[model samples]
Target: WSEPRVWPLPNVWLGVSTENQKWADVRIPILLDTPAAVRFISAEPLLGPIDLWNVNGINAIEPDWIGGPTAGTGCPHP
Candidate 1:
């Protein structure tokens, strides 16, 4: 008989991405619907401004943390 092997899992249960507005707009909803312990989005090295004002997924999940280009990085949110 063969013995079964155990697989290791990651400590962080969050999903991470650096998607731009268009991609994020489409994919965020799907990620939100998925069963994850946490969800995260990173706008670092951001190409342009992202308007999340009307993204229902964000409103529903209300993520604990968000990261992106800050002051002096020349990338600002409008």
Candidate 2:
């Protein structure tokens, strides 16, 4: 489904899944191109460390918020 063109909230949130380094690598580019008041990633069930420092075509993409490892392994958020 396509997102609504109009949002009533003052800020809009957009998220991408980052369950693994490879997944994050694939989705980061799409996140970078999409517009949002705050871009975020769902790092739930984090399988491995995510190195935003390096990825092909990765353009310093930074998430406004990242949430969860949800696996009960440890605190993924602080």
Candidate 3:
């Protein structure tokens, strides 16, 4: 069956994973625009830094949740 045209499905939660700023920049916007009951970001195995507040230079949207390793732990610094 084809995907539904109506977005922001009632029960489905959508998310994107990013290892660093580069991928975040590439993926986050797409995820935000696509509709879902909930939206999230996964920064697991974080290889570098990311500034969610500054994404797209517009500060237009924010994820419902952000998950990843704690600071000074799994994530590495530049």
Candidate 4:
């Protein structure tokens, strides 16, 4: 099982533009649901604001830390 984020290090950071708002919404909880100490959301690629049903382990929700059309594209257009 994945470990939860420990204090002094923000946890549960998801790339907003990795796919879409759905990506952040769906994945955020999964990360928080982990047995981490302190969970948070990156909310990067802030195309727009989002709202979640519940944030179990999430302690903080950072504002637009990531963005752009192809923000978190790992390999690039290869």
**Higher-lDDT candidate among 2 and 3?**
3
Candidate 2, 18-71: lDDT as tens digits: 766788879888976776666666665566667665544332333334355434
**lDDT, candidates in the order shown:** 0.51, 0.60, 0.64, 0.52
Report clash pairs, candidate 2: none
The residue pairs found clashing in candidate 1 are none
TM-score of each: 0.49, 0.55, 0.61, 0.48
Candidate 3 per-residue lDDT, tens place, 1-78, comes to: 496556556777677777778998899889867766777777765667677755532323322233544554535444
* Whole-model alpha-carbon lDDT for candidate 2: 0.60
Candidate 4's residue-wise lDDT over 1-78, tens digit each?
399845445543432232345676678657755655556666555554455545455666655534467554422221
Put down candidate 1 lDDT per residue, 1-78, tens digits, no spaces.
Answer: 297633223344554444357766776778678655446565544555556666543322222233544443424533
Error of 1 at 19 (Å): 3.8
Which has the better TM-score: candidate 2, or candidate 4? 2
Ranking by TM-score: 3, 2, 1, 4
Location of the lowest summed lDDT over 10 successive residues in candidate 1 = 57-66
Off by over 4 Å in 2: 1-10, 54-78
Scanning candidate 4 in windows of ten residues, the lowest lDDT window is 11-20
The worst-scoring run of ten residues by lDDT in candidate 2 lies at 57-66
